[model samples]
Target: MDLPALPKPITVDLSRAALIVVDMQNDFCAEGGWLHSIGVDLSPLASAIEALETLVPAVRSAEVPIIWLNWGNRPDQANIPPGLARVYDPDGRGEGIGATMANGSKVLTKGSWGAELISALTAAPNDLHVDKYRMSGFWDTALDSILRNLRVDTLFLSGINSDQCVYSTLTDAASLGYDVVLVDGASATTSPQYCHEATLYNTRQCYGFSTTARDLQTAVSAYPDTCKERS
Candidate 1:
């Protein structure tokens, strides 16, 4: 099947844009948790981290705030949908993957693994982190308030599991009127087709555009004065 062609080269207004990293957690990306149960390879975790290495410095130099949205679930299934909670033992305490995320960025835990950010990725002091109970980052989470506080109008999204959490958060962000960007190569899924298909369908259609980290970097380098013009 032919994949969608890249959209036109676009530059966002840096002064009003922010980078939103979604549920790139160990449970989904590493050897433990639900995703591994289905035989998914998390080597993409490394790819995502590499993408961040190329993109983060550029976004940071542009003064775009980096936001990490992680999960913090409760022992009881009270916070999540009953159907989701019932899939696993509510009281079970399982260790995910091998290590915790060392990204020095501000960290937020959603669902249960409040301190872990997928066991990989770089962290920086200025990064913003928030914990979410549900799939949507805006649902009962500090994400909205943080974005508002930063005066962010554009959200550049990256992270794991394209069909579930990432897709859910992007849809929610679009409905709220924020300009969105999906860093295409910075995300992955247990199913490669799932990731690619989700981005082609919903990205830019309901939310904003889908771009690669490299393309964004180049645009930023070529148009460093973006804040002076419309995105």
Candidate 2:
């Protein structure tokens, strides 16, 4: 498939960097998933997933920790307040707390198919996993703790819904003084094309930087390895 031209990626310090792939979940991409069941096209998601299939391994080879930042929330979803709750199923079309599609895939509850990562992206055993309740993984989660522990100062970001969770986390990361990079080719949204464009614009102009997978590889290749052993 012919992919669109992505913005040039910025070179990052490999030693202090990590690739944070956000919310590539079944509910948003798979055919019987929540978004697919609701009629949203999964093409954008497929593109990101495809990009990561190549990017994940290369980053891992660099010993850059790959954090599978997903929405592994409480089964009750008690952390989700009503204001943010409406976004999932505002129309009440059999899509709410505990709702499931015809395929027996639970909608948004934790431990359900909808809340799990899509099968496309592989989750390695050593990969850091964090279950988040909100769009921004930094909010009320162990994200900061994990990053600090890993000695990560630069964050390489990709994943689904570029305009939402990806955007939110990037903003916070920038505010907190962590150098942020958005891999546009690996970060997509089913929202309007303009939304994706706006995200790229805001990310570059406000948060940190925008980039492509090829450029990212160039950046990763620049840094020399300190300790070859994976932590």
Candidate 3:
């Protein structure tokens, strides 16, 4: 069968491009933390992380920064919305996500869990972690300053809740004038179809472009010398 045509070719300035990984915590991606009851699965989360694993070396080789974006918040039920309560409330005992993934990396927490990255994908030495309070990564977060400090001109976006957090991040990133690439497969929502469609729609409309983690890995390998910032 013929595959769909690839999107327009876009190159991230290795020295100025950064990978912004949104919430990949157990509550969001694992089998039983919070939203799993709603059908959130670990398959895509693992797949995305695996893709990052394959692409990290490439990013490191090119000197581009790999950032891990997480969420952390006070242990208060009032913080969570009524609709999201059944999934992430204190009753759910959701604080383990961040603690589970804590390691040698810059940590950023948002909400109560601080938008924790999954335990399966811990941060590396060169990784920068940022905690966000709102939907967008740039909203009162150190993300913008860090990007500016790194002279980053492009952002490779991925993570949980494709229709919410990921979408919000992409929108903000685009408005900020940074070249953005949304990894459709690297992200998953409570609903797989919704996540997929959201990624496509947002990429084709608001974001600069979209691709899968595998394809991005291929792109990185093609330009092996393009992302060597980690080592």
- Give the best candidate by lDDT: 2
Ranking by TM-score: 2, 1, 3
Each model's lDDT comes to 0.66, 0.79, 0.64
- What's the distance in Å from true for residue 11, model 2? 4.5
What is the Cα-based TM-score of model 1?
Answer: 0.77
Model 2, 2-36: lDDT tens digits are: 11223433444566788999988887778888787
The prediction achieving the highest TM-score against the true structure is 2
The reply for model 3, stretches above 4 Å from the true place, is 1-6, 37-46, 76-116, 224-231
Angstrom error of the Cα, residue 95, model 3: value is: 12
Query: Model 1 over residues 77-160: C-alpha lDDT tens digits?
Result: 356664454332344333222223343211123333433665557658988888777778999888988898888888888886
For candidate 1, the C-alpha RMSD (Å) to the true structure equals 6.2
TM-score of 2: 0.89
